[model samples]
Target: MNATAGHDAYANSLCRQRVAALLRVPILAVALGACSGPGADPSAAPESTAYSRPRPVTLVGYDDDAMEPFLTRDGRVLLFNNSNDPAAQTDLHWAERVDDTTFAWRGRLQGVNTDSLEGVPSTDNQGQLYFVSPREYASTRATVYRGRLHDGRVESLQRLDSLASSGLAMVVFDAEVSADGQWLALSEGRFVGAGAPITADLLIARRQGAEFQRLPASSHWLAAINTGALEYAACWSNDRRTLLFTRAGDSSNGGAPSIWITHRGSDDQPFQPPLRLSRLDGFVEAPALSPDERLLYYHRRDGQRWRIYVAER
Candidate 1:
């Protein structure tokens, strides 16, 4: 290989090694006081839970890929993506909880699902929806969009210019808004080239009046969460103090990626180190907690299809 090609190969190999090393070290944390920023009160951090064994959730009845599970603040509604028919367009769907363990399908989301793609739906207390989709079919990256949920339908779809104008060429995916709509957490995939692989990192955006602005990457808890690993699909607890997300795990243990959870003293405080949910093994994604924070919802690949699973105390 030429000199440039040789350097690229060497860089990729180093990245792979770092990811493997990170996977071996189950719980990684930065210096205890490294994240003491404004509005941070170290003594107020929430109590951490001892990792528990979680069982599979059987309520979701999608024969296709049903991932990126998101629950509303009330926990009465569910939103996710479906791609059962590989030849057809991947779209978003919703369901209403019938009981603690059952849900009634509400069918495909209207006014949001387009011929291109739509996935990763989240909402605030006011029922405003946020999701990711391409600006156009030929577009290289996807952008985050905001819409209103009225009478069980999505309305008034519009692109969030503040985030879209962050001056990054990446595809935004899996997003969650805080209960009060003041904080936005999403993942972006930065690709190497046209046919090159993509690497993802989590980003937090704060709302300013009608627009949203991203936090400086340097001030973020990137070292603890990102860690040169593919991290995404993060959702906050009802109180916005706990965060659950997914990242690449050792393949021998289960799948390429696994579920993890972290805690913070408050919204202003950076996240404490994350701990992997060892019991929820295998190809898991879309890690989310119930509105009440008593249960967790996620999905794992089963055969050629993906199924939704949940865990409760």
Candidate 2:
């Protein structure tokens, strides 16, 4: 099936599942597995023995699916986005664990405005959400917004309007909030031409009262490489000292992007030189560090499609 048709089919299936759940009916044909494609290797070594080998975790399928998944404090709930959704226009979606490795599709989390295009979901220790939205108030461009979750429901979303200004020209893809909720790290960039060039750089914003202000470029350790055209998808360590990001400089390098890590005194300080994490020739992007900082979860492209992989520290 074509991409659009596949997405529609998946959506219809999910809708059916929702209906079944509402009617207290149990249907037995739910296949939970990663979609097959060039980059998706069914034989890749499993990351952990704690989990079953060759078990497929559903990230996205059918439609041009890109998910930014993050675990909550308890690690039972997963929050992400389904870009192919036709109704909400690429809105945030959530899933909760039904068993050890199985998650039931809980409907879209409440609180996001249906009129907005929301993606890239991240959470802090306090359950506050930070995501990107192309809503009207955000000047019709991708801007970062935050909302607090109370009792599994979201409150009103508040945009970081100052970052959406013309001079900033930054499109934030992902953000990470510190455990204390005082520091925020984001992958953002300024547009150089009409097309969206992968020029995003890692930026740090500090919470000042009720607002966040961007820190100067010179303040971070990776400041030297925070240039116009070679970075995206940044994540922070639990302690907020180390940062992991993706770098795409030369198109001919490989199929997957490279992952880099940096260290700084604090969020306001400069980052050190970045070191490449994966030596594999494939493309690696969307690096998420485990809470203990011992393992890394990222998607690597083998050919046309991207597959999730876990790397041990």
Give the alpha carbon lDDT tens digit for every residue of 72-143 in model 1: 878888888774232446688988887655677778888888765577788999899998765441232336
Candidate 1 differs from the real structure by a C-alpha RMSD in angstroms, to one decimal, of 9.3
lDDT of each residue in 156-256, candidate 2, tens digit only: 77877655535423445557676667777776644333322334567777789877787675344566546533566677788777777765543223322
Taking all chains together, the TM-score of candidate 2 against the true structure is 0.68
Off by over 4 Å in 2: 1-66, 84-88, 98-102, 113-116, 137-142, 150-152, 193-198, 217-220, 251-256, 265-269, 279-281, 300-308
Clashes of each: 2, 15
Candidate 1 residue spans exceeding 4 A from truth: 1-62, 84-88, 137-142, 165-169, 194-198, 217-219, 249-255
Worst 10 residues of 1 by lDDT: 18-27
| All models, RMSD in angstroms | 9.3, 10.9
CA error at residue 7 for candidate 2, angstroms: 26
